[model samples]
Target chain A: MQIDWFTFGAQIVNFLILIGLLKRFLYGPILDAMDRRQASIRDRIAEAESKQEEAEQEAEKYRSLQSAFEAHRAERMQAVEEDAEARRHELLARAREDVEYLEAQWREAIERDRADFLHTVSERAVTETIQLTRRVLDDLADVDLEDQLVTVFLGHLQNPEDALAKKLIDAFEDADAEVTIRSAYELSDDQRERLLEVLEKRAGHSLTLSTVTDRELGLGVEVQVANRTVGWTIDQYIEQLLDEMLRQLEADLDQRLTADVSATGSMASVRHR
Target chain B: MEISPDQIVYWEWRFVTVNATLVYSWVVIVLLGAGAWFITRNLTVGPDISRWQNGLEVLVGQILTQIETTGLRHPKRYLPFIGTLFIFIVTCNILAVVPGYVAPTASVTTPIALAMCVFVAVPVYGIMNRGLKAYFKRYIRPTPLMLPFTIIGEISRTVALGIRLFGNMMSGNLIVAILLSLAPLLFPVAMQAFGLLIGVIQAYVFAVLALVYIASGARAHQNNGEPAPGDAEPSSAV
Candidate 1:
């Protein structure tokens, strides 16, 4: 084997040229591309991390806002429930007051009706009793009721008690004191003279007297001296009887009302059960 | 048969001549340069890349990795020299499988030329990495009296580098030719196949030895005036 100097030198030069060419075409471009790719990947990773951090922050912000909104909702709901409860109580109280007022008005109307009925019945009974008594005296005793009333009044004057005598004397001592006599019917002159004589004898003085026919007296006479009066009248007896009757009627109505109230209370308790 | 491509001259003009070795070397160079230019012309810096670009990248990357593993701190600084040595030799050896194609590496003149390039590059890279004074200081390391022996060691290893590649490639070709004449079929084909494997291995061996010489020279100052690991025995059995 032999080596040629010219071939050796030419091959060396060729290898050197190949080295330069390969470097320019291969190593330089490939390495640069790889380095650039690596840098780009690194930048992308950093950007992704930053975006993740921002996303987490945003999520946290939204979470807090949601919690605040939930708390506010609960508070508002509580306030609304309280307002509703208060309104319900107010409405119930107003309804109860209205019921009580209406019940009172109804009871008052019933009481007024009962009182009017009792008054009408009492007036009719008194008029009937007085008429019946007048008819009985005229039919049985053959004496007029007015004459009897006058007789009774004269007796009360003639036989006056010690206190009555003193009152009459004191009344007669007033010189300007005039006597007014009211009767159911017009008195005969003889009856008036007799009443005057009796009164004057009891009083031990002379008296000025005025007679007035008042039909409301109902066969009774009244002698009034100033503001004082002395009389015996059927109207007074009838009034006493009507008052007793009214007391009895009121007692009955009160008892009935109490029973009705008790019954209503028992029914209300049953419904509650 | 002629042992070297230098004997097959196509033209001559006194000392200047055109021979098979020069022609085939140019052919390998053109093929490598054109292929590199074509594949890397439209190279992308993105994750997506062409298959050809991928293959080229793998090749250049492996060469860089090999240089780095040879104790060179900056592998890229030695990539062009060491990478070209491997590619050119491997391509020439691989093309020997083609009919009537004599490998340029089978020529004593081509291997001697490549060895001389490595010889020159070792000092150049060493001086560039560690100053000239520090680079030359490695010859007299351990003692100044070892200078002549270190010089002889350097020269002999360069000679060994060239002769090792030339002997292996030439013997494989010679054996294949002799086997073709004797058995003429199966043995020649098998030996040719075996020669292909040997060719690739010789390429690797040559490149690695070259990287070792360059690395030892560059790091001589860093090893505290002692020679680097491969400085004592830079030759490869392959």
Candidate 2:
């Protein structure tokens, strides 16, 4: 057996070249690509994580905003309810005032109508009584009541105790114009002279006297001085009696209305007097 | 039939001779170089790999793992030398099944040349790792009296490595050739199959032994102050 030095040397060189070629092409490139792929995977994972974090934050922000909106809505609802309540009370008060005013106006209108009716009745009754008195005196006495009224009026002028007559006399004394006496019948010359003497004596002054026949005076006499007239008539007594009766009726109506209002506790129950 | 390729001389000169061993060894080397260049030319660094590339990667990866399992770190550093040894021996032995092909490993010349490479590499690595003085100092460790025995052991193991491979390959070829003349049919075929198996085994054995030797020498300094087993145990009877 023999060894070939040159052949062994050549084999060693061939193996070394093979090693160089394998290292460069095979090991180096494969390892580098694997590293790059791994790096890319890691980057993708990191980016996904970041996106998830941002999404979570956005969700949290939306949640907080929703909570705030809900709270604001609740506050507005409460305010609206309070406003509605206040408006309801204001409307109620205004309605009550309107009711009370309308009730007062109604009561005043009722009282005015009652007063007008009572005045009409009382005036009619007084007129009828006066007419009856005048008729009865005319029918019972065959004497003229006009002459009698004239005589009585002359007699009152002579007496100092007659208040109406005294007032007339004073007026006559103060008169700058002529004094006139009007009656329902013509007076005789003797009666006229008598009336003139008594008036002058009571007055203690000289005065011009005039006489008039006024049938509208009925059984009354009127004496005038300086556009002033004083008269005594049955109509006056009828008016006084009517006034007293009206006062009594008004007091009775007021007491009944008070009692009815207290009993029913309703102002609507009041009726016309 | 020749038992050793070195006996078949093609030409002769004053101090240079051309023989079957030289020719076959060159042939294996050329095949290895051309194959490596072709396979690695379009090597991809991505997942979409060719079948041939896949095979090479698996082969290289297994070789690296085997060297690492021998307690050797940096398997890549020793891969070129050890891997080349495996490929050359395996190709030379298995190609013997061809009618005209004489396996280079069946010759004492080829085995001795490979063993001498290992022998030279062991000290070179030891000296590189532990420095020149420390590498030589390992022979007389624990006593000065062991120097002669250590030298003799080294020389004897180198000679044994060359003889071991040459003997196994030559004997298998010789037995099969003789059996071919005697029992021409079944036994020779069976023997050739067995020989193929033996050839692959020897390839593994030689590669592993080269790795062990280099690992021991290179890592001797870092063995926690313990001595390295510079002489590895025989992996096969041959």
Candidate 3:
């Protein structure tokens, strides 16, 4: 076997050229692509890590804001509850005051109604009693009763007390003074003359007497001289008895009303408690 | 039968001649260069790559790994020279299975030329990595008196590298030829299959040896503080 220098030289040249060709086409581009891919992968990883970090930070910020918001909401809720509680208490107080005012007005109206009813009852009772008494006396009255009332009036005139004699003398000093005799029934002429004579003797001067029939006198006689009146009549006794009865009835009604009011006040106080 | 493709002259001039070795070398070169250009024309930086690009990457990656395995720290700097050697040699050997195709590595001249390239690249890389003085100083390492032996060892190893590849490739082809004449069918086919395996192995051996030699040269001075070339494991079993 022989070695060919020319072929050897050419092969060496061919191998060198092949090296250059492979380096340019294969090694250079492939290696560069791999390097670029590696660099890109590294950069992508770094960018992903950075984004993750940023996301974590943002999440933390949001968490903090949420925490603050929760705290603020809790605080506001507490304040609102407190305010609502205060408002409720204020409204309750106003309602209580309104109830108290309405109760007081109701009690006052009840008392006023009671007073009006009592006054109406008292007036009616007094009027009815007086009317009944007057009717009874009128039914019972006759000439005798009238004569008796006149006799009683004459007796009071004839037997006058010291104070009555003075008041009678002073009243007769008026020369123009006249005596008016009023009776529930008509007086006879004899009875009128007697009544006049008795009044004249009591006065120690001659008196001018005038007789009148007054049905409201109720079997009684009254003698009026000037502005003084001196007579004994059933009307006086009846008036005194009516006045005592009215006073007793009024006292009874007042005591009953006071007891009722006290009872109502005690009940109202229990309800308030 | 011609034992080497160099014997098959296609054309001859006074001092220059075109032979089968030259012709087939050109064919391998063109096929590799065209294939590389075609596959790498649209290389993507993404994970999705074409099958041909994948194949080329595997081939180039294997070469880079082998270079690195030779204790060369920076394997990329020597990728062009060493990677091309592996690609050209392996391609020539693997293509031997095809009909009427002669492996250029079977010729003594081609392996010698390849070994010469490695021989020249060793000192070039050595000087480039270390200074020129520091690189040449490795020749007389341990003593100046051993300089001639060291020089002889360097030359002898280079020759041995060339001869080792040439002998293996040539012997396999010669055995296939001799077996074809005696038992042309089964033995020749089986021997050809064996030859195919031997061819690929020889290519790998040749490239790995070249890488180790270059690495040794480049890191010769630096090996003083690190693992010397002798102490480092061989790149391949061969």
Identify the CAPRI category of the predicted complex in candidate 1. medium
Q: Estimate each model's TM-score.
A: 0.70, 0.58, 0.73
Candidate 3 chain B least-lDDT 10 residues: B224-233
Q: Write the per-residue lDDT of candidate 1 for residues A1-273, one digit (tens) a residue.
A: 777999999999999999999999988998787778779999999999999999999999999999999999999999999999999988987776666656656765676677668666866776687668766543443127677778877876676575545566566665354788888788878888998888878666677878998765555788888877777766576668767776776676667666655655555445434
TM-score of chain A of 1: 0.52
The complex in candidate 1 yields a DockQ of 0.64
Q: Compared with the real two-chain complex, what DockQ does model 2 have?
A: 0.19
TM-score, candidate 1, chain B alone: 0.96
Native contacts retained per candidate? 0.88, 0.20, 0.89
Candidate closest to the true structure, highest lDDT: 1
lDDT for each residue of candidate 3 in B1-238, tens digit (9 for 90 to 100): 9899988888999969998899899999999999888988998877788898888778778888877777777889999998888889888988888889999999999999999999999899989999889888888777789789877877888888999899998898889888888887888888888888888888877778877788888877886624365434265545
**Docking level for model 2:** incorrect
Ranking by TM-score: 3, 1, 2
**Backbone clash tally (model 2):** 0
Candidate that scores best on DockQ: 3
List model 2 lDDT by residue over A226-271, tens digit each: 8788777655665677677667766866675666445443553342
TM-score of 2: 0.58
Top TM-score: which candidate number?
Answer: 3
Residue-level lDDT tens digits of model 1 in B3-77: 788889999999998999999899999999999898889998778889998888888889988987877778788
**DockQ list for all candidates:** 0.64, 0.19, 0.71
